[model samples]
Target: MGVPATVSSTSSTLPWNVHRLPRADGSVFLVTGGNAGIGYFVAEQLSATGATVVLGSRNPAKAENATASIRARIAGARVRTVRLDLADLSSLQSVVESLEVECLDAVVHNAGVALDDPPRSETPDGYELMFGTNHLGHFALTWWLMPLLSAAPAARVVTVGSFAAKSERLDLDDLQSRKGYQPKRTYGRSKLAQMHFGIELDRRLRAVGSTVASVVVHPGGALDSLTPSRPPIHVPTTGARLSAAPAALLVQGKHAGAWPAVRAVLDPAVLGGQLWGPRVFGLRGEPRREPVWNHLADTSVAARLWDASCDLTGVDPGAIPG
Candidate 1:
């Protein structure tokens, strides 16, 4: 399918520069799975804005290490770790309670699970692992965080979707993939659900006259081999870097993959419900606001997914205070 036209284009005369970001002093932001990969880079870049970045991870040790790495790179960086296990829907309320901030400026739903092979697994909640951790997990988290998010002047909920979602569509009847469980196809469905959630959330927020913005972004094609070294967290060997150098012309590293999420959080012009992705063929280059995929633009499908999400997760995001 051909790419859709952007909802609105960023000015060509003065394009957004990812290297320099607007200062977000005193704001508080949360990044799920911030211990490594794209989440770690998102946390690191957000910390540069002087915002107190909370790295939400299931493992305490990994969270601490991620925070340490961020502190080492940025002086006086106010960063902390939170114990978050998105797979466990029951524990999420307590996780949100653990956050000390009175108001949350933004949250990046960057964490996810992608099982390569199967023997398909299920979360403690009994849902398929990928859908459970990626979509339902963030759905429940957002439901609980509505109050804090509403307190901010203009809060943003950034859902990091994937290009993998482009061709997939949710089977609302079998959201768990109970019938035929293909790892790759299931992973794409999970992300498609997430993208639907982001857009549906914006529609609901607008209906209620809420100021909270729901933005969706996809990191176009990121590879670990092309990623920058972050000490003990991630250190690509010389051989790995050299081998991946040629591919750099096409795909980018995890650090560069984080640009869309970061830009969605800080850019004043970015509106809720718009999709963002890489500038060059949705693969690599600077971040730019992009048009929603044809399959992803269906409101009826998104609405059905939203209703299913609320039912599965047992939280009505529509009930959140405007």
Candidate 2:
């Protein structure tokens, strides 16, 4: 498909630069997996705009290093670290209980195992590794933070989705992938579940008259080569550099790739239930609020997934007061 000036009736081509984002001095954002990849860039950009960032990672040292890097790049940048392993519910609960603040401005659900070889096994929670970490982990985290989120006047929950969502179908019977599992398919299914949750979350929040905005976005195909060669944070191997050489033109850097999620979190005009992504090939281009794909719009499927998620994670969506 040719890159058009606009994507659909609801969206227009949005040429954006991270520098154009408004100052976010007093706001606080919790970014999962903020130590690297799109999550790291998102943290850097958010902190650059003066937001207080709580960088969450499974590794305290990595999270600390990421915080140090952010502080180094953006002098006086307010940042902290939180230990969170999404695959573990105990870790999620412990982190939430440790939060000192009653409200959070935004929670960027950006952490997940993407593009790795298929997990040989399931998570501690007994679900497929990809699904558990990508969808279920964020699901539980959001539910646990619902009170803090709802307390904020108008908080936003930005779930990081992927192009993989465009091509995968969910197996309601085997959401855990007990029957079958392929790396790419599993990744796509997890992301699709996330998009479904984001959309349904918006609907439920509105039904309960909550002010939280639930938005989903995908960082277009982001290549490590397109990203800067930041030592410690991202030291590409010779093979990686070689692989990225010919593919550079096809993918954008992590900075440009981070645009959609950042916009989803900060763009005041972005409404709940909206889905955003790159305009060109859904891979690379400016962020645009495009139509939700047909499969992703199936309320029945979303409702089922929501119920399953609540059961699997022991988080009741209805528990959040209307």
Candidate 3:
């Protein structure tokens, strides 16, 4: 059952609120870009609920600090940090190899980037940074770690997609934006690809009889993320000053934005193929309810985008662990 635009965000029968999100006791969870922004809060809130969290960040120092802060805030919480740069595949491989396969109950594909960077930039492996990091790197990492997720009962894989994804037109010839990169377009396309991958992933999971559910969420509002072509960096949060109203009342806080995603991962009742985000039109309010984005249902384009992502990432969706 796909969500239609006619379904208003406020129509949620449960009147969902973030404070009441369900728990994840005795489970191990993984989150990428968990050092700051929405990912930080996602880890914090999950840890608050007694889940063992393995947060990933690009910088070792930053990862350590973020983990320490989480421990400080939630005494006795099981939280650790691993160095993971989505732009770097070697790090993804090393991290996957080190982890105990089949222990993760959930994996949050939360890392992302933005900003108008130089026309062309490449990953250490010479692939385009934006697509490589935002989609393919995460793609490889998740599949490699699938065995771990499948071992857990009712595990989930959540991709932090973007609303801008609805607007991107897949340009297969210039996926990396090699010839002339339009910063926003490149970033937008990567996001779109992520969303498509999420949708296709859901279908693939069912086919394999995997207990894991693949879900997608758009946090809403800009949180200092850059496209892959940009840098892996965290900017100080802007919510304390803005959390009062319009930002709170109008714009969604990155932390607040993460609530829906967090809920989707932990709440067993969440239906598969769900897309979470803000309710008050676009990205301006209510983080708990189903954010109505009617545009995500363009299955044709989504299927094409999914096919392209598979080609680029080199992972056969069918071969993923059950």
Highest TM-score scorer: 1
Per-residue C-alpha lDDT of model 3 across residues 5-103, encoded as one tens digit per residue = 222233345555577544456778889988877888888888887778888888777777778778877889899877788887757768865555446
**Which scores higher on lDDT, 1 or 3?**
1
Cα lDDT, model 3, residue 229 = 12
When 2 and 3 are scored with lDDT, the better candidate is 2
- Point out the higher-scoring one by TM-score: 2 or 3: 2
Worst 10 residues of 2 by lDDT: 1-10
Q: Rate the local accuracy (lDDT) of all candidates.
A: 0.89, 0.81, 0.71
Steric clashes per prediction: 0, 0, 9
lDDT of 1 by residue, 1-322 (tens): 0001111223223557888777777888999999999999999998998888999999998888899999999999999988999999999998778998888988999999999999999999899999999999999999988998888878889999999999888898999999988999999999999999998898889888887889999999999999999988999999999999999999999999999999888777778999999999998988998988888889999988988888899898757756
Clashing pairs in 1: none
Question: Would you give me the overall lDDT of model 2?
Answer: 0.81
- Cα deviation of 248, candidate 3, in Å: 4.4
**Could you tell me how far off, in angstroms, the CA of residue 115 lies in candidate 3 after the best superposition?**
2.5
TM-scores for every predicted model: 0.95, 0.91, 0.84
Error of 2 at 228 (Å): 0.7
For 1-322, candidate 2 gives per-residue lDDT tens digits of 0111111212223445557666667777899999988899889888877778888899888887788888889999988888889989767877776667777888999998865675456889787888899999999999888888877767888999988789888999989877666788888899999889888998888888887878889997998877776667887788777777777667788877888988777766677888899878788878888898899889999999999999899886535852
TM-score of 3: 0.84
